[model samples]
Target: MSTRGGGPDRRGVRAKVEAQRAAERRAERRRRVLLAAGAVVVVGGIVAVIVVNFPSSSSSSGLGPEGMALQTGPQLASVSSAASGQTVDGISCDSSEQVAYHIHSHLAVYVNGQQHSIPYGVGVVEPVPSTVNGGTFVSASQCYYWLHTHAQDGIIHVESPSQKQYTLGQFFDIWKQPLSTGQVGPASGHVTAYVNGKAFTGDPRTITLQPHEDIQLDVGTPVVPPQSVDWSHAQL
Candidate 1:
């Protein structure tokens, strides 16, 4: 009778040990899983940082404003400015769009008195806005941003939904061109500016783009009168 009772007790102890070992195995598996998940999280964060800091494909190639590629030429060289102006939100184009029913603005650039072209493309939109510069003109649902260029009028068509103060400095940024206190494009000299025929007192880059406003930037010698934009019918 004593031997039989001892055998039963010994079997129960063995079962308890087996259960404890199983519990420890489960705990070990969970810890390994947690470690793997933490490693994945760290790797994902690093990738996101790289994408944000690097230039996007569209902007990387100097393409901006109405699908026009920033034309590199003998006189023009790529330059960056420390002055980043207030960016007016870009929007789709509209046939009936206007600065208001009655207000708009213009921009002009001159180097050595001769008018420097404000380039071809400034504020342009397409069906696939991001792929606009990828070539192939997209019309139909085409749009326009606050600052845009049409033809060689040297005008920045600030056709917005309402009347809000815009800046010449912002216009330059949209054009993907360079402008500063004493430099416009490849031309570097004393910079002079005018607003509605009145000489600007402060930095030329900060000139206000009010409705029917005419802004001019002149670099180097020969400061001719800024070509006037006849507001008589100027509605863009």
Candidate 2:
């Protein structure tokens, strides 16, 4: 009879111990879940911060070939005479980049279906070493023409002291290159001109350098079609 009574007590104790252990296991699982959720939140926040802080250089809605990106090919020409602070076509070269009437335009050239790049420092004189906002050393020029370029991206920066009309002819003159319906730079043949993906019927030189305008010139046979570029992400 005593053995029977002791058996019930032992079984009851064993059941209680099992119940307590089950509760502890549940608590541990809950802790692990909470920790995992916290880690996910932290990682998500970091990704959001990175996305907001650093944007992509290329645009999602960009057109034409990806080769249109800046510095994709060899430079077309060196800096023209305007780089020496000489006045060309009434445009002056100042001691610094002017921002009073800042604007940007793009130009592209193709010879026999092959693309050529426009060089940086086209109208800037004597590039010097300087640090940018990110503490990166880059070539900064001593003088800047009203029409200039800071990269080999075919972007013509029109940073003038005053707002006024400028034309492709003036820029070419500043570049010390010749442009006409018959010729462009060193390449000579039947010249085809395009403005904003449309054939420009008038003198190619007379094409105005408007803000965000895309200009292209094709030389010789196998004239390439007008190409477009994504200016949406340009920092000009």
Candidate 3:
């Protein structure tokens, strides 16, 4: 009888050891689950940081190919004569050295020295290309205008690189509503101009030019006459 009782006690101790082993295994599995959850959280935070710092790929910007949001407002700049070495005002300026833009909208054009504002962004009915002696020519619709130095032909030509059927009048019409004027200055002997705060990259500059130099300023986009729309869409 005693021997049999000892045997039963030994069996009971073995059963307890097995149960303890199973409990230890369950505890280990719970620890593994917690560790995995922590790792996932850490990795997710790292991905979020990378996405936030990425650059934007949008149109209508100097940086991107698409139209993207930008900062625009009234800026200050000057348009000088390319031929006579004189500072031409809006009234007596010549088409070769100066362009007096008339704005149909109620927008204000503050002159370099004049305290009161003037009317800009109006008058011309079509877009025409006028080369400058020093500054580069660009269409307003493709992008904003930023010029350096003065050219002989100080005119802003209205033309669309898109070549869509739109009138120069229509383009400037849209601009008069939202556009503001800025200034053109010099840097390292190089004269430049920025219209409507479009050129913000280099140091802040103004519009100044040597004799016979030209600076082109775009006040609006050129519209393509409907008769000129290329059926060349067949090229596609």
By lDDT, who's the top model here? Answer: 2
Candidates 1 and 3 compared: the better one by lDDT is 1
Per-residue lDDT of candidate 3, residues 1-236 (tens digit): 24375587788888899999999999999999999999999998888886677544331122111111111233322222121222212112123322232111111222332212121212221223344322233222222221111111112232222222222223222323222233222101222223233332332212322221222233322311111111111111
Off by over 4 Å in 2: 1-7, 48-68, 80-82, 128-139
- For TM-score, the strongest prediction is 2
| Candidate 2 residue-wise lDDT, 110-166, digit = tens | 877888877766777775534332221224456778887666668888899999999
lDDT of 3 at 210: 22
lDDT of 1 by residue, 38-118 (tens): 999999898889788875785545433332233232333221331123344344445434656234566666778666655
Sorted by lDDT (best first), the order is 2, 1, 3
Q: Which ten residues in a row have the lowest lDDT in candidate 3?
A: 63-72
Cα-based lDDT for every prediction:
0.59, 0.76, 0.29
Tell me the lDDT of candidate 1. Answer: 0.59
TM-score of 2: 0.78
TM-score between model 1 and native? 0.50
Deviation in Å, model 1, residue 182 alpha carbon: 1.0
Cα error, residue 72 of model 2, in Å, equals: 3.3
Report residue 53 deviation for candidate 2 (angstroms): 5.0
